[model samples]
Target: MENKTIILTGGGTAGHVSLNQAIIPELEKLGFRVEYIGSKEGIENELIRESHPEITYHAISSGKLRRYFSMKNFTDPFRVGAGLTQALNIIRKVKPAAIFSKGGFVSVPVAMAGRLAGVPVIIHESDVTPGLANKLAIPFADHIFTVFKETMGHVPKEKSTCTGSVIRSELLDGSAASGKELCHFDNNHKVLMVMGGSQGSALINEAVRENLDRLTKQFNIIHLCGKGNIDERLEGHEQYCQFEYVTHELPHLLHLTDLVVSRAGSNSIFEFLALKKPMLLIPLSKQKSRGDQILNANLFKSQGFAHVLEEEQLDAHSFLAAIEQLAAEEEQLIHAMTEAEPPKTAYEMAKLVAAHAK
Candidate 1:
């Protein structure tokens, strides 16, 4: 029990890092020293270093794991090899009891290093189907945790388990008034929050902006427009608030929101489900991704937790119509969310890790 240190790794996107962020404080409370290994420039470094200053953060070289052909494909292996060496060196110094990975490209090397270092590597997969990194890291993982039960079929059955969703406790503690004050938004109109994931979707941003005048008439807006995606023209617009991204402020924003229009990332949708927000989902198309968002969105739609709008059919008019439809179904969606399974708290999930740790 003396070596209660644990190493957490993930990055590239917010989805890959959320579960790790959620469990960090609980891990600390359980007396584990949490050290993180992430890519030098990935969002994970900014998030963990800024939000959890007590945790030691390590930067390692990592390459993107792309499905399509890219010139980087030829050079990424050398970068990955360097990352493995870095991760193993870190593992040797920390001698963590367990290494938990959320399955991003950076995690592949970390998981491999953990196996070589004889550390128990536990991975959490948030999509219906595994991501490319998780698929590659599965062999190195001692156990894989999934948010979707269907994912069990994609990984080694004996080594994987469905733990359902894990939500951060602070996300549920937000005050609506505090959120309203933060945005300077009056309660005259209901608030609608639009998120296009951590990277922001240009398609979603354009549609929302083109229709902003129409939408602002009915609702106040909080737009998480993604990094470098904010339009300078919209800076002083009344009833519209835009941010490149948010970290700790997200919970308050969610508390202030009455409706949501967002990408169908599992972590985000599950957070909406926990908050009982009526949502209109715009999933990333198969052309853009592995179509994991399409599956995540459709599942929520079937459960009555969301209204799905495919990219092909989305336009200025359809975007407004979907918002109207979501508003009309608000009560029903809330009821459905009420009946759904609640998410695990950070402490409970941390305990799960401790139970399985080497």
Candidate 2:
């Protein structure tokens, strides 16, 4: 059999690239050569380059999909046009059998280019509602895979299927003992992990710091503080360990965690659910996002998988109280999560993409 090639395009944020990360190995195992197209300096480029160096990475112009007015918005359409041309050239050159898009601004052009090149395109939507870029790319996509069942109603039902989230397999094999050793946590205390998405959250960082002294008394804390968000003032606290960000060690850190405090990014929250970790979610407010995080938090809360604390309501007292509440209700959350269906779609998705390959 001839070696087939596929192109994966997603970027701008970690959420857009995570599904690709989860599916790449499966695709490789099935004998597909994978290539990635993203912006020159987007988080996707950094993540793919660092984690999967074997993937051929292509950089294209990136345009921001803004909902609000900005001067850059005027110039960005041209950027998108340029990106489409670049993607078209790359698609023509590589002659990929199929294109898999994870849905970001960078994906719009690639999806369009793939359609024009007569390559089958598969898009995965991670949010309850389609994001702007995905919304635009839908017409060009041959198949749309959704994480939420409700999302199918919003799209052309004929083209969309509910696949659940693609969770990284390594996350399931984490060693609790290794995690405990890494954080220096004793069995006497429960371990709490705070994550603020990939870039870190200033709001969450401040809240955690203000409540650290009180929190440390009950739980050992492992905080993934995001790049450049670490506090030098809290450097020597034995009960609290801080990392600017974690990649290879994330699974171990998660394994040791007794509870999680995090943003309601779809990928991260779904991972927490997969791990059956009881969580307190502080979603980004409408001002910061398109309200997807709020919807994600609400869905998890309604399903009894998590507790939601709006960022507007977060303070040191409220934060501590929420943690306490999550602790009290941890058993219920874990039970609900355990009863829920696991996301077993990585292999299924890989097969679906390969089936479409020319």
Q: List TM-score per model, in order.
A: 0.97, 0.98
In each prediction, how many residue pairs overlap at the backbone (N, C-alpha, C within less than 3 A)? 0, 0
- Tens digit of lDDT per residue, candidate 2, span 1-358? 6539999999998989877987898999899999999999899999999999988999999899999999999999999999999999999999999999999899999999999999999998989999999999999999998999989888999988888876888899899888878877655688999999999998898889999888988999999989998899888678998999888899999988989999998999989999999999999999999999999999999999999999999888899899999999989999999988887656777887898788
Q: Note the residue pairs that clash in candidate 1.
A: none
lDDT of 1 by residue, 173-276 (tens): 98888878778885579999999989898989998998999999999999999999999998977799999998878899999999999999999999999999
Global fold similarity of model 2 (TM-score): 0.98
**lDDT for each candidate structure:** 0.92, 0.91
Largest lDDT belongs to which candidate? 1
Compute the lDDT for candidate 2. 0.91
Off by over 4 Å in 2: 1-3
Error of 1 at 164 (Å): 0.6
